[model samples]
Structures are given as C-alpha cells and as structure tokens.
Target: MPRDRPAPDLPEPLAPLIDAHTHLDACGATDAASVAAIVDRAEKVGVGRVVTVADDLAAARFAVDAANWDPRVYAATAIHPTRANVLDDATKAEIELLAGDPRTVAVGETGLDYYWPGKLEGCATVEEQVEGFRWHIDLAKRLRKPLMIHNREADHDLLAVLIDEGAPETVIFHCFSSDANMALACVEAGYVLSFSGTVSFRNARDLHEAAKLVPDDQLIVETDAPYLTPHPFRGAPNEPYCLPYTVRSLAHTRGQDPVELAEASTATARRVYRI
Candidate 1:
C-alpha cells in the first residue's frame, strides 16, 4: 500500500523549486494527464521545474516526449546501471540521438549498485556497469551537459571509476547516502550533492551532518519522489510538492534561512542542468 498522506499545509513561500533528479518515467507516472497533475501540485507548492529521468529505452522515449509536451519538464537519458547488460550497440546509438534532443539535459540516473545482488541478473555485469557509466560520462562531456549519478553501496568503485575516467563537466550525486568522508571526497572533486527526503529523517544524522558540510553552491535538493518521502510524511507517496519540507530540513542542518536555501538551490539546479 502507498503511504498515508498528511494534511497539507501552505508552504512558507512560493519561491521556485527545481527537483534536480526524479524518475517520472520508471515509476509509471509519466503520462500527460498524470504529469500535468503532478506539475500542477508542484507549481502550487512553488516548484518551477523537474528533470524526469529515464532508466531504459522505452521510458527514454516517454521522457523526451513528455518534456517536449511540457515546457517545465526536462529529460535525462541513460540505461540504468542495473540494466546495463540490456544496452546493445543499437540502443547506444538511439540514446546518443535522444541525448541530442533539446529537452534531454543530462545523461544519467546511472552508476553502481551492489545492494541488491543478483537483482540485475543477465541485465548487467559489474564490467558492463563500468563500461556503460564511462560511455555516459563521455557523452555528457561531449554534449556539454551534466551527469546525474546514482551510487548505492558502490561508492568506492564508482569514485575510482570517475576519477580514472574523468567525469563530465558537472556531476550530481542524487540521493546521496554516503558518509561524511565520502561526501567530502566528492565535494573536493567538484561534484554536487543532491539531498533527498531521507536527510529529513530523525535517525539520518549522518545525512544531516553531510548536508551541513556541503557548500551552499555545491548543494541541491530533491524528493526522488514515489520514494524517500520526508519525515512527518514518511511512507507517503512523494511528489515535487513535498520539496519544501526537505528544503526546510536541509536549511536547518546548515543553519541557513529556508527562503535563501530555496533560492540558492533553484539557481544551482538551473546552472548545473542548464534548464
């Protein structure tokens, strides 16, 4: 069952919010009417834009079509690391063409994930994952776009690969869950850390600490919606409308003003994604 919805409250201010990373395509939430409904709710809560990610070929087409239909929606294309084995030469060529679309802003939602062993059986081997990630990295660099990374329990290997291959012009670590040291390393490498609702959990002290350590310009916020709903609303189906709660929590951790945090994050999102 989806989580319970809490009584909605008016957000502090309707400053524009940008959900830097979200899987609108993969979550069975990418249709026009549904997308419009979600965007409307986001607009009501001050969210101005969203970068909907595609985890596979069919979804990539949906992402592009949706973005073309809605000016506020942007797209990111990549074969998710877990599904890397499915990426054939034809798929790669198609993705290259898709990446050239104006609305396709980044190249990812890709990286390594060892947490669910065998979950990607016959989908992608570790070598395939590495090769696919490197290909996307190169694509991002060539296209002069940022890369939205998803690293889950594969930080060390992921970092090593990025360092060795040299990442793209800009890299955003979405739903960052690594410890402070890894956070520091990423920051030092000139990467952006996008915090999610998980950072708002009471027991997420490590995330909070990492949030505090992240420089203002190098930080961004997201809902990773339909997942990682913020505290006080945990278990609920998350949407861009819930961003303010996560932003407020992030501000609290950094001892910054909520409005300022919102503005800075929006600007950072625009600058990074070139939206």
Candidate 2:
C-alpha cells in the first residue's frame, strides 16, 4: 500500500533558527549540490544552520562530507542503538576519526530504544544496545563534543546509563520523547532537551506539558527532518525549511513569542554545538 505523503511547502518565514538534529542524506540529499539546494531552501525561510546526524557508518561518512560541503551544515556521527551489534572495533575507529573532524560537531543519535525490534521495529538485543551506548558516551567525552542522544521507549535506562557512566558536560536529548517528569529530570540534571515536530501533535498532550517545562537555555527546537514532520503536515517529507512550523507550535506551547523562542533556541544550539 502506498502511503500518501504531504507535499512539502514553505511555512511563514521565521526569525533565523537552527535545526539541532536532521538527516540530509535521508532527505534525498546525497551530493554537495543537492545538500546545498536543500540548505538554500532552508535559509530562505530563516533556518540558517543545520546539524545533520548519522545513524550508521555509511551515513556518518556522508554526514561529515555534507558538513564539509556546506558552511551552514555540521555533522554528528555514531552507530544508532538498534544497530548496536555492528559497532565493532573497525567501525569505532572510523567513527572516532570522523568525530575528530572540525565539521563533525557531536557524537550521537545513539542511545537505547526498547521500542524497536522487540517492541516495535528495530534490531539488536538489550546488551548490545547498552554496549554501543556506553561506547558512544565515551567517544563524546574523549572528543570533548556534545553527546546527541536518541531515546525511544527507554528513557529510564538511557538516563540511568548516562548517570552511571558519567554523562559528558554537554548532552542533548534530541527529539525528546518522554513525560513531563522526565523533562523536569533532564532539566534538573543540566541536560538540554530538543523538541521535534512531534511536540506539535494534538495527541501529544504529555509532550506539550514537557515542552512547557524546559527552561529557556535548556530548550531547543528541530525538524528531525525526513521524519516527525510537524502537525498540519504530519505525514509530509520534512526539510529544514519546515522548522518554522515546529518553532511556531513550540512557541505557542511555551507561551513565548515565536521570534523570541526562535532566537533563544538558535542561541542555545550554537552554544551546544559550538558552530
């Protein structure tokens, strides 16, 4: 069955903002020209910068290359939790080298995902996932870069491991998906919570509450592009330009002016990624 996808379009231009987490490669942008075209579209709508994250070695290599190709792009590299079993020595060595690049700003999009494979859709056992998560955590610490985490149905375990292993100084829970209590816990622990388009969904009442509690400096916004497209276009193919929709929705949820929130979120992103 062919699922109908919403046509991508420009939302109203917003104050220039940053997409803290997205995947340019997954968005059908694999070459420098294609990446630039996508980025240009984003800039026209006030999305001035983007962080393209990779979930596997192949994607990580492309992410680094894309970042090098465009000044407005930066990369985050790591093996995704579900692919934990594949994180052998050779792969880690390559990722380590990539993480050292100035264009690669973070080590992540890696964490626990109990929802996958066993619960929904994913691979690797819990043990394998934990091993990969710990390795990535260490990579971020040693590289002195922010740790970008992707948690899905394993928030408790994710937080526990970060705590047990001593989280890096800068940690970002990208596309945060948990309850308000977890949000508060992350804030209290000095971790940044990045909200994605999912926050805008009417059914995500708990997510709405969580967004409201994230402090100004600790809160950031993202499109998580090519997935989690914001409401009104929930099933659409997302691009950085679609960020305004999510930002506007987040602003409404936070009860702050949209421009104000955009500026603050952009600033927070820069501070975290150091780009």
Please state the error at residue 214 of candidate 1 in Å: 0.9
Q: After superposing candidate 2 on the true structure, give the runs of residues whose Cα lies further than 4 Å from its correct spot.
A: 1-3, 119-122
Cα RMSD for candidate 1? 1.9
lDDT per residue for candidate 1 within 1-275, as digits (tens), equals: 23567534545655778988776754456578878777777888898899888888887888888898888899988888888887789999998888889999988778887765477446677887888899888888899888889898898999999989898879999999888988999999999999998888999878778888888789888878768888788866777777898999888888999989999999999899887
For candidate 2, the C-alpha RMSD (Å) to the true structure equals 1.6
Q: What are the Cα lDDT values of the candidates?
A: 0.84, 0.91
The CA lDDT at 254 in model 2 is 87
lDDT of 2 by residue, 4-98 (tens): 68556888899779999999998889799999999999999999999999999999999999999999999999999999889888999999999
Candidate number with greatest lDDT: 2
Clashing pairs in 1: none
Clashing pairs in 2: 117-121, 117-122
Q: Which lDDT value does model 1 have at 1? A: 21
Error of 1 at 166 (Å): 1.3
Query: What's the TM-score of each model vs. the native?
Result: 0.93, 0.97
* Alpha-carbon runs more than 4 Å astray in model 1: 1-14, 26-30, 119-123
